[model samples]
Target: MTREFTTPPASAEPLAAPPSRTNRGLLICGALAGPVFVVTVAAQALTRDGFDLRRHPISLLTLGTLGWIQMSAFIVAGLLTAAYAIGLRRVLHPGPAGSWTPPLMGVFGLGLIVGGAFRPDPALGFPPGTPKGNADPMSWHGIVHAVAPPLAFAALVLACLVIVRRAVMLRQLGWATYSAATGVVALVLVAWPGQDGLSMRLAVAVTLAFAWTTMLAFRLLPPAG
Candidate 1:
């Protein structure tokens, strides 16, 4: 009897791997930008009175350099945010309840961050009241640097929560889910109203929450197999 040789059946498709730590790191890098930029803007706003570029001279230059670094960080962070969002879209697939939601929210958040970066404001102080008498756009510092940017940042956090909720309900609380939820809570705390001691407590809470999300993002990227 002649036996016909046949090709072996193809192996079943490989199972998907878990997210890798490296990817987690990248995602964290992207997500952290939101908090960092928010804090920077806050710092600038709080110190406006003391931060005069003309009188401080060298100090002014230093501050300017720091500002550039913060801006650069935001850009890098935006790219990373986009990248992770795309990854989630892949796993979650197309649907209102899938991965797309969180990431899209993230993109919007990034927009707020990036856009805020472009907003101009007065160097530090300029008449303790709101703008008046047709002020120069360049001199519109406080609003641009403080309020608008943080609002944008808050938008991202809100987006993250909406997306993450779906994931949590679905029992798929991965890095993306955690990051989104934690970010939202953090932003909210940061924005809560209070002065002195209360402000410090809120700030700490926000920072810690964001930091947790960041840590997960860096540690829990989906694995490639």
Candidate 2:
């Protein structure tokens, strides 16, 4: 006698539907946030008067006639980044990186929003007419602005560390190394001494962080298989 086994019904098997459009859109939004922020700030830096990229920080752009523009950019970037954090949560698996990255990114985004809302005081002779010095007496807003960046930077650094560990676990040695290096560079640049090239270093650090974030978002996309 011959025996045969019946195949399971299609419905009984796990459905393999394509990734939802909403998730795709959210991933794209997260990817675009960095470029949008960098380009907007670069444009403002080039056109705005008394805005010395070497001696002054981009946060100073949130002052004077065109202040609203940078302020809006900051808020927009932050919102996009926060949304991306949500997307990250949906896409990443329930592992070490997945557990840590989303929340850290959310904190980074929040720091951006808070920093933008509490605009930094005039310093390094920005806005064309301000005194050639730091924000004397340091208002509450200035203090908040000062604190926000370090907090955001710290979060991003931690996120990168998580990514590094995740990459190592996945056997992506190159990515692991890159993530570790990026974190180190960010930490060093943000802590650089003196005012010279501070803006450039900070810009580089922010760019590196966002570039890594965008790449990670792309990596987390569901495989086409």
TM-score of each: 0.51, 0.88
List, in order, the clash count of every candidate structure: 14, 0
CA lDDT of every candidate: 0.48, 0.80
> For model 1, how does the per-residue alpha-carbon lDDT over 6-122 read when each residue is reduced to its tens digit?
452232111123445554454555456546645664565456555432322111212343456545545555565566565444434444434445555465446545543664442
Q: Where is the poorest 10-residue window by lDDT in model 1?
A: 53-62
> What tens-digit string does per-residue lDDT give for candidate 2 at 1-225?
999996644222111223566666666777887888889989988999878788778899898989998888888888888988887776664655777888999998888888779898887778787888887799999999899979988998999999888777767788789889989999999897986788889988988988887877676554332
The regions of model 2 sitting more than 4 angstroms off are 1-18, 223-225
> Candidate 2: what lDDT?
0.80
In angstroms, the error of model 2 at 183 is 0.9
Question: Highest TM-score among the candidates is held by which one?
Answer: 2
As a TM-score, model 2 comes out at 0.88
Q: Which ten residues in a row have the lowest lDDT in candidate 2?
A: 9-18
